[model samples]
Target: MTALLNELHAHYNGAKLDPSSITRHLEDNLLSPESVLKIVVASDSGGEVVGLLAFTFLNSLVDPAPEKRLQCMIKELFVKESFRSAGTGRDLMNWVIAHAKTAGCARMDWHVKATNEAGIRFYRSFGAAPVADRASFRLMLR
Candidate 1:
């Protein structure tokens, strides 16, 4: 799990992943239910971890609808390069969709890098579209 996470983080940030930091963060968030949920997909042949999906459920303060207050946001999704075309990503996403629905989430949302054409295509395959009116901004604390 650490290795897979390292690969995913490095691919985007080009930073070395600290196993202890990752483990600690997961433990802290997971200990509090609904903070973050992580799911891993393993290869059937050798039980090697091939993909991972992490998402969080949040309640929008401004959304007045009771049943629609909760929204699921995918924090990260990644599949091993060798497993990209093997439906691993699809399976992980399908599971998250069902899980969110079952939990009464109003919607599921995520962002993909504009330069990641393959990621964009994969999300679009499931009817996901970019929100043209919105732009993503980030601030680095560290």
Candidate 2:
């Protein structure tokens, strides 16, 4: 998992080791299932993991403010560029969709940069929307 995280971080940031970084944020977030979903990957060629996808589940009340919570949000997700356009992403999405359905998520949400045309097109091919309107602020929970 650590190695896989490193790889994903490297691709996302274009750097080897980034501090105060999303990689740290993700690793710390993974301490509890309440925070994020760490997807499992299978690989050959000596069983090296080459990708990762991290998502956060947020709960909300719809009517009467129920004791339970409504579902949503895939905070972070990625597949290594080398393995892209392969079945790996499909397999990963299959798992995520199933999990989201089981979790009763009203909708699954994620975002890709506007500059990422290939990613946007690939997502569109899956019948998923590529754009989002958001205000992202990092919380200082420490």
Candidate 3:
């Protein structure tokens, strides 16, 4: 877990992640371990942290769903710069999807930056379709 956090911190150039926040979160939540999926390293070498994926789980509202009856949010993803095109991200997404399937999830969702053309393309390659009718906004607490 610590290894995964460090990898994402390096990839985002100190954005998207705050190490102290993760530390505090682990202290609070790792005890019971809820539905949230935090950053996790994908490593080849025993101690090497290459990339990570962060996600969350949600119960599906729809009735008569065939799968886990839950949904997943792909919150954050990152591959080491040298490993970007090496299929690490794809593998990570695959793992997430498999996990959702095991958890009886019916759907998965996540957002990407509109300006991230490469990211969009990559996500599309993984069968992520764009929702043209919806809009999203966020409010900063501070």
Candidate 4:
């Protein structure tokens, strides 16, 4: 799992991930029934993990409708380079989307870097569109 995270970080040109932090997060989520985090992994016949998708279930008071109150945000979706185009990623995505719908989520959302043309293409093929009205922002606590 840590190796897969490292590959995801590489794809983002981001900082190295700390295995201990990852372990802590998994442990916390696993032990908490109220945890919103859900991570799904796909393994090969030989039991090697080839793809992963992580997402969070969210609720917003802004959506007055009960069915629209719940939403899902995909934090990451990655397939091993060797597994690309083998349907692993699509299978993972389909599984997550179905799971979200079953969980009463109104919609599923994710972000793709502007420079990641391939990523954009994959998402477009999956029927995702850009939200032109919103811009993403973040602040580092440290």
How do the predictions measure up, each by TM-score? 0.84, 0.69, 0.75, 0.83
Lowest lDDT sum, 10 consecutive residues, model 4, at 22-31
**What is candidate 3's local distance difference test score?**
0.76
Q: Give the per-residue lDDT of model 3 (tens digit) for 36-119.
A: 565555886665667778788777666556565678888888877777889999899889888878887788889888889999
Compared with the true structure, what per-residue lDDT tens digits does model 1 show for residues 37-102? 655455547877889888888998899798889999998888987788889899999999999899
- What is the clash tally of candidate 2? 0
Which residue segments of model 1 deviate by more than 4 Å? 15-35
Error of 3 at 11 (Å): 5.4
| Candidate 3 vs candidate 4, TM-score winner | 4
Each model's number of backbone clashes?
0, 0, 2, 0
**For residues 75-142, what per-residue lDDT tens digits would candidate 4 score against the true structure?**
88999889998999999999998998999999888988888898898889879998999888989999
**What is the C-alpha lDDT profile of model 2 across 20-48, one tens digit per residue?**
46457655676555655655564546776
Residues forming the 10-long window of minimal summed lDDT in candidate 3: 30-39
Once fitted onto the true fold, the runs of candidate 3 whose alpha carbons sit more than 4 angstroms away are: 1-35, 62-68
**Model 2 per-residue lDDT at 71:** 57
The list of candidate 2 runs beyond 4 A from truth reads 18-29, 32-37, 61-69, 130-142
